[model samples]
Target chain A: MADTSETAAAPRTHVSLQVNGTTREVDIEPRRTLLSVLRDDLSLTGAKPGCEMGNCGACTVLLDGEAVYSCLTLAVECTGREITTIEGLSASGELDPVQQAFIAHDALQCGFCTPGQILAMKALFATNPHPDDETIERAMSGNICRCGAYPKILAAARALAGTQAAQQ
Target chain B: MNTFEHVTVTDGNEAVKLLSERGGAAGETKIIAGGTDLLTLMNASLIAPQRLVNLKAARALRYLRFAEDGALHIGALATLADLERDAGVARRLPILVESVRDAATPQLRAMATVAGNLLQRPRCWYFRGAPHCWLKGGAECFARDGENKYHAIFGASSCVAVHPSDLAPALLALDAELLINGPSGVRTLPLAAFFHEPTNDARIEHTLAPDEVITEIRVPGQPEGANGAYLKMMDRQAWAFALASAAAQLSVEDGVIQQARIVLGGVATVPWRATQAEDALTGQQLTPELARTAAEAALAGAAPLAHNGYKVPLARELVRRAILRAGSVPHP
Candidate 1:
């Protein structure tokens, strides 16, 4: 437990989270969300806190290769599951294909929603390597880009779909 | 968010035992499967519980399969994304897929469970963010006369908030039943009986007791050559709740309707099953004029609030479209 004296009414539990392919331990209350643990505790700030509600997908992350809203996910419930963040996308020190596609298509402005958007696309590509435009739009509809960069984002996703189809 | 002791239960029996042992006070202990709605409500300081029983690890309650009787059985913990991407559901009962396909975002669909979606609280702005509202034990519903563009048009008792789940209406149309497990035992109830209008005495929605938990949802197969359609009209293209939606299932033979079910969503406290509309369609020929008449019958008793009169027309049009689509009737 991190701070027992601060709140004697509630006790904190030790939670082991696998973030970015590494196991990390943190003692926190059950109320702490996975987004808070990722940003404040582990210093993996790639997952931004946008609305804090599930309405906005700014805190999107991959849990067992499926994209889910981390803000709505409790940190205590993520044991034994593979968690991947935006930092994990480029673990090889080279920009992943989705990241490269974003840069090539100019898919972001102000860049607050870029990481969540990219990770959402990464999860989509994991399952459907070559998605059509409707599938791509439906998959990326969760991540809201405030800068009105949807056309470019769609272009980036379409490009990835095209390249993946070519490789196949 | 208020801190609560988190406990993990592997199955329904353990969860029931924990609830019974913990005294099973609705305000004290809460059950969480996906935490998509509960966590949000807690974040807004709506309903605070002392403990949360995590049911995500209940592997026995996370399945989706069809029984030999042609009924599709879905575990309570099955996610909306799981239903959307399921080939069997798409083939056997496509209305379920259509209902959940655009209900929420991709991330939310991946996280929200079928039970949570059915048991989720109302999305009325006043009910959600207001300090005092009738649904939350307040004296009056603020949305009754204020900012009620999204409130209910039908069945407004003390609260005007509308039901938010897109899957409930579709399930009700398919004649779904729930298997509820409690300390007493497991009992099955029709999906229609599970929901009721909120009154001054009963401030909450749904009929699930404090100690009871929904284990499974069984949707019986439709009639032979039956088809259905779910149409939702939202303010945005996606990721927003429905302003008004319609789910219509019909079994037609020789261009005549043999059986029909019409359920409307986002227009009432519960999934409003239009029996009049169903009666109007039964034994009638599939035609655009008949569809319009059925749609009119569905909204005949609607009493809309001042700001939400638009929902009546919107819902009527959706009902008409859903009926036409379900019967494969062409409309100009």
Candidate 2:
């Protein structure tokens, strides 16, 4: 905040983030995006930079409990928000229901898109434990699976929805 | 992406002041609302601002509310997902929801904001990845002659790039108004006149001053019992920009069209209003013959470039189908 008019490469700002229930601090260039920081700085390579743009959701992460494209998100913009990545999903060391369902249905082929797809489904089920086919389709549309494992993915989603409904 | 300093501002006044000082000629300083579009531009090196003004700390600008006058007041930072999931907005204006639901994927909607969507640059490959284009202060538009499939089919003068927002057409059909905060203080303008075809000096879309920031968008409530529909034809089944889209709103009084507003997207440099088609529908019954006649009127002055003639028929049919869908008429 000192040099308001410094046009050339303003000094980096210190950013404190609560990523995956753990506090982390970093002093990086302001131009760095959240996806770059998570992958490069923090060694959290789960969120891949498929497009490095908003078009591809391979870098999807939950920012403040809502799913957002990390590649499009500036790291400095996410100062106080809670970030949940694929590596943070299984805190209990047991496979989450979505992961279990994905494995049960063999929802992944090449596995490049699994982390993003799983995180997207995790965010979907957080709000809607039992989603219909259309809801699942709309929610997962952002994460593209180049392997074309959509049928298996849909089966996994349906299986998770059934389990949630039966428990309810 | 070129390296630049990022300045975070907490208030609207501060943001505008910083922008005015640093955002000089040729976009030296640029404002970051949601970064959904800006980041992509920077990533491709299409734009390299000297300084980036991040408004993420301006929490006051993030809101969606219905005012006492029945006008919907949407702040600049209100994300697409916020509009799509708002119960009141959904009940009052399902057309907005429909416009956003099919726009980008779920993650993109969560990151894209109202003002960002409105002010986003075109998705033209030439304008984006190419070294120079007329919109970027270059000599000519590449899409005018080369690979112009997704280019404009109407109202394209020097540049054929189409307006890429699905929300702009929907808002324009509802006659929305925009409030801008700039060096001269706050002023409001009708959204229709806010957008213009690319002029010689003003090559970019929209007439916002470099210092001005869109603060709020106000949509007056639709006429009682009015119905609206949005139809988009995309290249793929999901996660793609519109090849052609239509937004139609009509009010029927005893099976006769009382009022109509028809606007087409992905066919023009701006959200094009099919005023002739709307006029043709006024005081007419919802019939297949009338729809075809109005659709033909909508595409009357369409001048398509190479490889984009398909958009003329696609937009024409969308306009017709959207009108019928808005009127709740079953397909004949």
Candidate 3:
């Protein structure tokens, strides 16, 4: 017979995931969100949970190579999927150009919405290397920084766009 | 908050099977795609459905491909992020893309699906607001009597929540059709016919049966002289619904109008198609005067509520601007 505590505990199911190219399996509640799965279950806390809803981009991550809101996504559906968090963007303590440029431009203050902002920039530049100011505005308009660092954020985006294209 | 049950289906057919087998004839099931909308409703302790079926795994509902006839077929599960990123959508259906671009933030867009965006509940202060409203089957639709500036200006005899889509109007102007799947199998209907007048049915937006799911949208290729555009007037540039918006499509021949369509957004219970406006443009010359006349024809029968009387003129201005823009574009 199962233990009495186990019987009363919320039922947890096993899910196989590949985060940043490493395969791992973990047990989680069916209703548990991928945000919690990343922060709590996997101990990859790079992705923050500022707004449990999708309104805030603090918990944005890449699912199967496409950007998605981890907060709104259920962990159960993430099985057999590839996820990329801020932690995976760099290899061996190196900085991705987008993240480095954001710092150089002073694009952040509170630093809470930084991970998501960087990820949004990464996702944007990955597809569009040379987006104009208008395209950048349209793309980054969804991620908000209450600190009003938007001007610097725009500058950082332009700098990264220029650098990313030069290397191409 | 109550813990709701969840079932994930792997394909469109499986989703239909679950709806038919589990929902049965009662038709009280709720379908969830990204849960960007349904979860918000559930988290807020809104209507509690008997069962919640997840369609995120339905491969058939996640594509943005073209049909053999050059018409675009967008699966219901295609995310707004996907829509904005597609070169095809930007090149051929910028009006539709413009609608998606203006809604929500990039984070929400990445998570929100097109079908969910269209089917999402109203954001009326009385409804999403702390207090109860009639849309949730309350005694009074607060929008009827209070803070109704954003309410409907036409076809809203009872309730006044404005239609919240920027793309629906443009899509309607393009004569898009939905491919729906219910227990009875698949069927299709034009987008204009999808929305019902409040008098027709105050409780529902589309004609979709409770057990049905929108599988794909069939938007025909642009005709010989097609030109389309969307305009939205909102308090804020992001995350807010329209104050009043308009979408126009016109085809010209030998400097004379051959075909035209106009639909009003954020001013009705549905993407309000303007038949009178179409009639006014079908045989007229592509002139600023003709566009103004067509604009007047579009708002001829508007019945705006208190505090929203300006919608009639706002709608007229947007209609005129949209038509002039469409008329000036080189025929595609």
Candidate 4:
């Protein structure tokens, strides 16, 4: 019983999406990506949309406490989910472990994909404090760095993993 | 660019209600979740749904559970991140995790829902190109004769875009079930039946009703003393679709195969369940020789397209390797 006509006379509805611990309600274009909502509506530009498609992980954000590509997600779809943008990585001005590690290891050259890469690394470190080479490779495969900063990124992650192990 | 109206639903029932109300002979209404697929279609102007319903608010539709009969019930909205994070899923259905782990980046996995993964549109260039091709309700699929390297080999007559969900084949191997809900009520179908080949339904990838929303995915629990494994062969090591892949589950008793499930991915239209492979392994001793023979049996009837001929051997080899690996692992 699908509508065969191209035009629907109904009006668009407004919705609230929990974004970076703050609820933002806005009117959005039906075709707008969640990336657009976060950056344009809420003005949280921490999550960058490098590739509009899900290919590059540059637009990665945490939806319901898990990392997901924001560019490929719709704002209206995330009405009730908790989101964690790169802005949430720090409480005040203090750097998160993953961020600190990236700084320590110098894990960036041009740094466009840094936010997404750090988030991926942070997620990996949280789950697996000590990841083998294969696991690291598999986990970080999606975030591409044109600057060839993979070795440094791995080093940063390894340093944090070491610290986490020592604390344990 | 064509613009469509957007709607968001809170649960499976609400999605059905929205669809029932919106999709009534005027035009198609789309249910978008992760937007991993829908955004591409919209950007490319391929599918112009008059109404778009977003299902990410459906919390009830995003759970992993064990039903009354020991079935591993996973809500369709369960994201790849959820699958990877769930200790129970990792302990029981490691292959599901392994398959989805390569679906995209960690970011995409967190956003991508299981049902959306199953229902994601095809990745064919023609489908996403500037011109309309056959798969988009046309008379011919452009991939049929042009740039069909990534197209289907088995169960493809008209449209040949390979079903891309990596977790799908693994689920089929373990005899997964999909629970769909719509205006007509609830419907339970096998994961194998969930997706149809081009001959069965050339217009769509799955048999889900226009108003149907995939609510739950149930994988029957593995029997006692059963081991499972999944292997994917791809172009590169990261975030790439499988060139060919296979998942195998086996129950071994005193070094002989007592029960087996063999499923192939990236080789057919749907999650290709290889009955021929299972038949070859039943009651056979668990050995490299036996595993290789069973793998060969799996691809015996495989019909390959022009550019994808190598997929036949690649898929078979993956099956052999996965079976051998699973068979060698001692069951608890």
For candidate 2, the chain B TM-score comes to: 0.97
In terms of lDDT, which candidate is strongest? 1
- lDDT string for model 4 (A1-168, tens) is 011112445344487887767777887656667787788778888788786778888888877666678877766677768888888889578888989989998999998999888877777876788887667777788788999999888778767767434433
Candidate with best TM-score: 1
lDDT of 4 at A60: 82
Better of 3 and 4 by TM-score: 3
Give the alpha carbon lDDT tens digit for every residue of B228-328 in model 2: 99999998978999999999988888899999999999988889999999999999998988988999999999999979999999999999899998888
In model 4, state the lDDT of residue B241. Answer: 83
Off by over 4 Å in 4: A1-25, A79-82, A87-91, A125-135, A163-168, B22-27, B329-332
DockQ of 4: 0.45
In order, candidate lDDTs are 0.90, 0.88, 0.79, 0.78
Ranking by DockQ: 1, 2, 4, 3
Q: What local lDDT score does residue B236 receive in model 1, on the 0 to 100 scale?
A: 97
Residue A155 shift from truth in candidate 4, angstroms: 1.4
Q: Measured with DockQ on alpha carbons, how good is candidate 1?
A: 0.63
Docking tier of model 2: it is medium
Worst 10 residues of 4 chain A by lDDT: A1-10
User: Tens-digit lDDT track for model 1 on B19-88?
Assistant: 7765787768889998988988888889888889999999888889988888999999999998998999
Give lDDT for model 2: 0.88
Selected candidate, larger lDDT, 2 vs 4: 2
Residue range B138-188, candidate 3, lDDT tens digits? 667787777788888888546678778777888889899999887778899
lDDT score, candidate 3, position B39: 69
Each model's chain A TM-score: 0.91, 0.89, 0.88, 0.85
